[model samples]
Target chain A: MARHIYSCPLRWSDMDAFGHVNNVVFLRYLEEARIDFMFRLAPGDGSPSFSGGSVVARHEIDYVRPLVHRHAPVTVESWVTKIGAASLTIAYEIKDPDQVYVRASTVVVPYNLAEERPRRISAEEKLFLQEFLAEEPAAV
Target chain B: MARHIYSCPLRWSDMDAFGHVNNVVFLRYLEEARIDFMFRLAPGDGSPSFSGGSVVARHEIDYVRPLVHRHAPVTVESWVTKIGAASLTIAYEIKDPDQVYVRASTVVVPYNLAEERPRRISAEEKLFLQEFLAEEPAAV
Candidate 1:
């Protein structure tokens, strides 16, 4: 089971009045990690890389701990938790060296942009996702 | 039974390679709407306004339609759905007069940041939240 980890830089604007990183910013960190993973599997030249357009069907995030503002980058670790014929579930964790801040998952569906509908994931793409499939379900 | 609706401004940075606002940015929109509602209830001078601290326990978003980059602002309509002694649920809809782009909900808990634990919501705060309680659950 392969897992991808990306270092996500934090911005001053990402902090909320609580002096901790805003909950919304965690999603951006996960997005950066997910995109990095996707591009590695299906490299593109500044164009639509996935077999078809991909849209996030749903996102669920559970905040475990409050992350404070820091100059150091936080790590976003992501792996495919499940893969269906037309959709895939990606699980993510935003963490630092010591503690995990959030656990999240996003359901992404292959979409046909021109037709504006859901589409099937290509066999090659499925194989790509399988390469990083988690051995077991993500505990979140 | 008052509902708050805010027109959120979009920035180019919010757009992703998908030629539309990234799913993550929708969370930011919801945050802005939530903060506006909070400020209206408890006014503070650029400091912590909530009694102690309110942390997002969880966030769930369902993307109804992909929002493309537009010059105009998108309206985020929000109202409280349920309130407990320690937590409350907020429901939101992102739209632009014609179509709804997303439906989302977040569970927020009154937290004791210094103590690093959840705290009970105060009576005064609960009273403030009740002012904008929704009559029924969100249809989406």
Candidate 2:
């Protein structure tokens, strides 16, 4: 099993009136991490290809602790937890160097843009995802 | 049970590469609706009051359909699904005039920001929340 970790920068606008990172802002951090993971598998060129795009069908997030504004960058650890024929699950851990702030999961379906429908993961794409697969459960 | 529905304007930046609302942007819409619902309960007059401030402890979202960019506003319907001693639940639906796009729930904990701690819902606050209490389950 392998993991892909991304370092996400924090912007001042991410904070709410309470001086903590707004709960909704965490989703953006996770999105960046997921995009990084996917692109790592198939780097985007200037043109489109047969590589299937994906859409999030579901998301679950548990906030372990409130993340206050800080100078340090946050790390988002993500890995594929399961890969069905047409969908896959990605699990994530968001943390600063000192503490974990969130644990989350997203269910993503392989999508066909031209057909406007979901499609099964190609053998090649599934092999690519296997490189970052984790044996652990999708949620904590 | 009463429900508070908010009309949220869509920003161009909210769209991702897929030409649809990014999965993460939906959280911001839900947050906006939740804030409007709370402020309606206890309008802020520049002073602190016992109508406790809240923090999101968890969020679960199911994407019923992808939302495409449009000129019209999106509607977010929010209601209080449960109120415990120190925490409450908010359910939401994101939709346009024709169809539903997302169903979501957020678990929120009442907090005393000045004291930096979770606090019980005051009797008055509890009574106010009862107006929006939803007898149905949190999500569809």
Candidate 3:
């Protein structure tokens, strides 16, 4: 099981009046990490990329504790939880060096650009994601 | 009931690789609208002005559709859903004027800054919120 950890700087706007990182901002952090992971592993330049499709899906997030905005950086850990025939479940945990801040999971379904609808996960994508899919709690 | 409709500009950073506003970004929009509403109604100097001590308890958002990043502005419609002894539910709808984009709801609980725990909703706050909470839904 391979895990990708991406770190991002906390901008001043990320904080709320409580002097804590606004809850919604966590999603943006997760998105950046996930996109970086995909680009690194897949490595393609196109609308749908080498997989011949795009991905879209839903997400669920649970806030574990408040994160204070500080000069310190935040790290996001992302991994594929499950890989379905046409969709994949990815799980994420955002934390500082000491404690966890939030846990989130998303379901991404492959989309066919030509048909403009969801398509089956390609063999190449499955192979590429195999390293991530093999480890820990299976995808839901 | 006084309903506030806020139109916010979409920043380039708000769009993901999919060319749509990332799902997580929607939450920030909601926060901005909530803060603005609070300040407009309460009339404060905008220094983390929720002196009443309120925190978000739960949030549920439905992605009715995707919002593309165009030059057009996005509108966020917000109103009080229900007010309880210690909690209040605020509902929101994000649209592009041409169509419905997303619907979200959040439950906020009053907190005791001194006690470090949630407290009962104040009578004054409830009374102030009543006028905005009693209105029926708009004809979308």
TM-score for the A-chain in each candidate structure: 0.88, 0.88, 0.83
Task: Provide interface RMSD per model, one decimal.
Answer: 0.6, 0.6, 2.3
TM-score of chain B of each: 0.89, 0.89, 0.83
Candidate 2 C-alpha lDDT tens digits along A30-112 = 98898777755444422232244778999999998988777778999988889898889999999877789999999988777
Model 1 DockQ, alpha carbons vs. true complex: 0.81
RMSD of each: 3.2, 2.7, 4.9
lDDT of each residue in A1-140, candidate 1, tens digit only: 87888889999888877788888888878877876777555544245546347788899999988887878999988888899988899988888878989988999887777887888877767877887898544466
Model 1 over residues B1-140: C-alpha lDDT tens digits?
88888989999888987688988888989988987887555544135445446788899999988887878899999998898988999998999888999999999887677887788776767888888888545466
lDDT of 2 by residue, B26-135 (tens): 99899888877775544442335334467889999999998877878999988888999988888888987788999999998877788888888767678778888986
Number of the predicted model whose lDDT against the real structure is largest:
2
- Supply fnat for every model shown: 1.00, 1.00, 0.18
How do these models rank on TM-score, best leading? 2, 1, 3
State the lDDT at A71 in candidate 2. 74
DockQ by candidate, in order: 0.81, 0.87, 0.28
lDDT of 3 by residue, B5-118 (tens): 888778888887667787788887887788777656643323333454667655666677777787877899988889887788788888866787877777777666666777
Please state the error at residue B71 of candidate 1 in Å.
Answer: 3.9
On DockQ, the candidate that comes out on top is: 2
Which scores higher on TM-score, 1 or 2?
A: 2
In order, the Cα lDDT scores of the candidates are 0.82, 0.82, 0.73
